[model samples]
Target chain A: MENSAIIQINQLIKRFPMGKGEFTALKGINLDFGTGEFAGLIGPSGSGKTTLLNIIGSLDMPTEGEAVVLGKPISKLSSKESAKLRKESLGFIFQSYNLLQVHTVFENVEFPLLLLDYTTAERKKMVMDALEWVGLTDKVKSKPPQLSGGECQRVAIARAMVKKPSLVLADEPTANLDAANSHNILQTMLNLNRELKTTFIFATHDEKVIGYLKRKIFLKDGLVDHEEWINQ
Target chain B: MKIAFKLAFRNLIGAGLRTWLNVIVLSFSFVVIIWMKGILVGWDHQAKNDMEQWEIGKGQFWHNQYDPYDGFTITDSHAPIPNEFKPEIEKGEMVPMLFAQGTIYPQGRMQPAMIKGIPANQTLLKIPTHKLDSVTDVIPAIIGEVMARSSHLEKGSRVVLRWRDSKGTFDAAEIEIVDIFSTTVPTIDVAQVWINLETMQEKLLLPEQATLFSFANAEENRPAVGDFRLKTKKELTAEIDAMIKTKSKGQSVFYFILLLLAMLAIFDTQILSIFRRQKEIGTYVALGYTRQQVVTLFTVEGAMHAVLAAALAAVYGIPFFIWQSKVGFTIPMDTSEFGMAIAPTMYPIYSVGLILSTTLIVLLTTSVVSYWPARRIAKMNPTEALRGKIQ
Candidate 1:
């Protein structure tokens, strides 16, 4: 990966309200991700990994310090500006597969493109192409309820990648999948990362997900403990 | 807005039975409110038309002393027909009616009745007064169905009529019922009888004198004459208008209740949807929807139920309303018993304005109810919502 940073963080702290007190989920966290980097925030539950991912994704704001994605300070962005940023340049994958249950696989994949101003033909082509990347082209007509856990995850991945966003934030993406399904999903994502040169940041403690990461940042009690790099 | 609509439509359709239940309830409100309002409009139109055709004509010129509700006023309400109306009366554009109170004994049963004398050949009113000229040995009289039923008098039935003339001399005679007419106007039908004008004048010893003159039209600029009150059609029908206005207010209460029930269903569904679909809401936000946009999506989803309800109402209500306009709705009891100008069967008339306005009202009400609960979405934390956590 190039040395250009797409995401920058400096002394970021996040506190959440907890009846009569505040719980600090992240404390003085410093991190940076570059273009096309396959990175994971590796930590156990309550380590604030998901909280850090949420901040980077512009879904949450920092209590102190700064987090900037695509050169825009997330803490200072208005709700509308933050939404526009996410719409134009970000994608998300969740552990529970957050695929719209009422929609067909193809419609779910086409949702992000619909938010943009793509024409009907362009949207159709993009959705079909994204479905093919996850090998779910044949199951495009199926609903989420009809799909297996792994298939649902594949659909979610296709939906996230349909717009070809600059960054993808995945929070324990493979937690609900079996071993084989986890590996298959990870391989597909890794291939997309290489082919599309898209930056991917993951918050996960799962070994299957950690195995696919090129760089791992270990977090403990809302602080980074250490970091590791793998040579593929 | 377009994307929101498309998503809302998909969400509503995908919601399956829950969506349909709310829609069905809302549709019932649409049909029933329109139907009830239509009936009142129909009744108002019919009552005015019947009064104009049968009793009031276009207007009336009554003697200044005439008080229709007071029976004692009949003694002094008579005045010689004005000479100014002579031309219209000769042209058959006006009819003079003379009124007197009398008692009738039909099969030894005593009943009070109003004696009305209308021109035998006049065509201005639809009273069938020409039947009065066919009498031979007895005076010819026409009574309304209600008067006939109550007095046990029918066409061709003879009854003893007792009255006093202008000379204060009591008179008794036999009268033959030549016709029994049916009319929706209670004032024209209940406890009233019609006879030849000349016969009534001659019997009452008051020639060339009448209580009221029914005209084909109310002349706006006509000079006021002494000892007469010129009542326009509107003025003559003011009581009916006041009655209908009062009735409409009562009907509005029913409309409010119907709307409340439908809105409650929509409100309850919206609240439940926000609670159950928190993750979907978060997914929308994560997919780049602002929390405001998420709230709008839910509101639109709730309001779309009204659109669906309108369609469903048309499916069933169109046929039912059309059939009702044709066959009409029958009252279980006698309309005359109500002492109003009501027909035994009433045909409903629905205007496009009424339908469109009713639809707009229902649509707006449902939108408000939906928006009330959907505002909760704007306060939800996207991070917690993404985990499907209750906020």
Candidate 2:
């Protein structure tokens, strides 16, 4: 109920229908995320960490109780409404970078902005500004395939932040990168969070990802086993 | 929508091989369908045009009764075409007299032939009088030069016509040869002869009747006939040329079926091309394109290929049509049995409507056929689709 808490979850549950019965992914879970926090949702594979992130991301619905972001009940939003909300209020960074490989980095960054009816000049300016923030301003004309794994991840970050979304969900954003590239990406994301006051939510199993987050939630068998917050 | 198109365009470029393959398959299918439609419709038009040009004005009549008892009875009989029926042959309406028979003898040689009685100046059906290259002004009682030469008939030489009379008796008439002509259309030149209708009708005592009548009237409504069935110029040819048309249509129908099968084969390839690009479609969806947008993208691609293929077909088709027009297309048809010109030229007459509609149909069929599969690709969930599990 705190003013800083931008995301609220109350007894949220998610279950997948297997052969006959149900397989629960997220057992009754309660969590709250404040504004401008670098949080990690960490667990081993199939630990329901990704499912929990997806439910919060409004990409999937919770089976029981409420999952709210920006005070909007995400599970109840219509597909279009959810899409609009995701476009307006959230940015996504996927493990594979998910940059449209056919497009240039600038075009990719300008993609989310195109969904809104922004002026051409405004879209250009915002894209360039976000690309600069990721230190990829010179690589705007480069395609994803032309860039290194680290640079592609940076382009993904630039695309996510170009719209200035309230929350950014990065699902294994550094999974495809090398150890040095992973550190660089994590550092870039942390720096952007500090400079832009953008909240970062990460779903990852990497130790490097956990090491960088101020707050960590470890999910085991769909239950939140550990929760910690560090401010420094 | 623009973003979707842009994305689709970009994706098409990225997937070059798959896109072109689909285009080629679709274009090939379209060309086959269009080509079949063109040939059939063209042949029909050519036949109709030739019939009209021969001044077969338009309609034909047949006797319904068993036999004529007397002139008075003939003037008032219960025939399908009553004897009292006298159709007005106006300026535009050309009522050329036609008396047809199977056998005509020249000296020692006996040959089966089709003799058409027409006006001296009236154009012969076999002679391509409309040709810009023709040197003669009026076609003079057109006949096969081969027959004329073999018979050693000079100009103005008399030839005897032998045929069965109404009472089934043998009748003979002598007519002077006016002219002789050679044509690639063997159906006319090989077994056909042309003479003045008035001369032949009087020579044969043909009840002063015309077996076929053609009237060029723009009237939307035709006047009622008491007993004789009134027909348009087109309808007249239908009656006189019905047997020829029926045979031609049958052959074309067979050709059409074969061509349609070929088109379907190409269409099957297009479908396969679409199936093969399922992953590419998943990539499209993951990029946030809508279903309709995706459909339009592939549809445009299909249309592009159609245009290319249609152009290619036309390149080949036009020359083929011209070559056939000059040399003629013959199938050794026998017109002796029916008493008509047997060596009809298979001239290619292009129908604009036929070509346009057929091309459009090809495009529609290919696009519609490509839709469901393309839609399946467009509507797939990125979460599952990007997983790339073969199903």
Candidate 3:
């Protein structure tokens, strides 16, 4: 494996129990993700993009073969060890902008660092900086219910990047946002990627997300068909 | 743990009216349980104190044949006063008494009574025995207010009293009521009459004799008097302790019911919270929480309701107790008919142990109720939860 490879998969297979049998989500597949790479697994629904992303993010494990994230095998890590990996080295953004509904915007953004056990002062500064990246520093006290869709997505972005983790995995992050809000959210993520040199992997079927990806891997029915690198 | 508490605290506070509703129910339980337990404790204390003061002194020695509950024993319950108690009796540290079955004719109505005899100047008891020294042509006798009312007699009212002597001869005399004392202890009152010890001995033709003796100082050494059996203060008040224990057992059912209601509210709230907050649980897992950590967070959130409830209880309970102290609780019905020493209006005493134990019980019950539903989080699939899917 290359020193720069933060995630590596070896003939990975994933299947979910379906009635008396099973349905394969990701057929035998292999992939690699290097440090500081801006990448996306692009395909339509049921094309295995999300299953692949979940494996890389350590939220799920391959049934056959290996998925090594940050040098820890996804299938072998204990529950505490996996949690530690997510806490210290990985972050996630969901499509629905799943901010803790009752918490203020600041508290939502501060959630990652809270798990990482940063000093209060350090956590406050980092959270502010992350919110500033998304231009949401002024809405610190507003809860999710009080915010617009665009603002809530920005808060989710701030939460994902607050700890400056080595990798961030976003699954259909723009699915619920309007085109304008989606573009703004993508721009903010792009700026964070360039500034901090953090690796970002997105599983998306939206063309708008595809336009921002530096590298796109297209999946066709649980198999990686091909990948294309764009010239920046 | 500290961070979990902070988050739990914020979450509970953020829940708004839903949070306060559960808290109010739990706090109400706190106040009511404490109040009920306090009443029983106060009753126990007051009942024992009254008995010690007006009825039994430090202790008593009953003649071998004496049985307070048996009327047949009263005829043979008398013996010459024990020699060992003579010095103490003279020193005012002890007093002797005797009682025999008798009948009274008051207002031309026949009534059975217990004719009790005590030293006119005895200081060992709260009974007004000195009133027997009153100068009157008729024998001066004292009765309790209950007896006075039932007999329709007043101070200076003369009534016919008849009783059998030690030799089995019957005699009758007119007795004047000199005093009508009031007391909480009914054992020494109700259908009873008191007169001078010497006067009773002369009338019975049996000098230097008494039924039982009560000592003022419990620490004084008592010698064995073959004719009498010694009873300690503890032995005499053991019944009160046993009675209080029985009352407490009955009160425990109320405690259980109160706790059950409060816990049901909390348990319902927690189930609803866990069901509705599936996305939040997913978000927590994605943000570096283990399934176990999420479980702990939810449990902490649930347990904190008790803490808040306790705070709310103190806000109202302290003042309520203080005000109640000023005006004691009035028994809704007459306590006299209970055949025990219960004041019509009794003051409740709250102790540190009672408050602390009650707080602990509520806290623990709430936590257990909270944790039961939170365990569901541990079995949830984080991948599905993030999408807010039903688990």
Instruction: Arrange candidates by DockQ, descending.
Output: 1, 3, 2
Query: For candidate 2, what is the total of clashing residue pairs?
Result: 11
Residue B99 C-alpha lDDT in model 1: 93
TM-score of each: 0.98, 0.76, 0.96
Best of the candidates, TM-score: 1
Top-down lDDT ranking: 1, 3, 2
* Tens digits of per-residue lDDT for model 3, B135-242: 999999999888888889998899999999989999999999999998878877889999998988898877898888888878645655868888777888888888
- Score chain A of each prediction against the true chain A by TM-score and list the results: 0.98, 0.97, 0.97
**CAPRI category for model 1:** high
Give the C-alpha lDDT of model 1: 0.91
Cα lDDT of model 2 by residue, A114-199, tens digit? 77789999999999999888899889789888999999999989988998888898889989999999999999999988888889
lDDT of 1 at B88: 91
In angstroms, give how far residue B180 of model 3 lies from its true place: 2.0
**After superposition, candidate 1 runs with Cα above 4 Å error:** B218-223
Give me candidate 3's interface root-mean-square deviation: 0.9
Give residue B249's error in model 1 in angstroms: 2.2
List, residue by residue over B196-239, the lDDT tens digit for candidate 1: 89989999999999999888965755555667788888888888
Worst 10 residues of 1 chain B by lDDT: B217-226
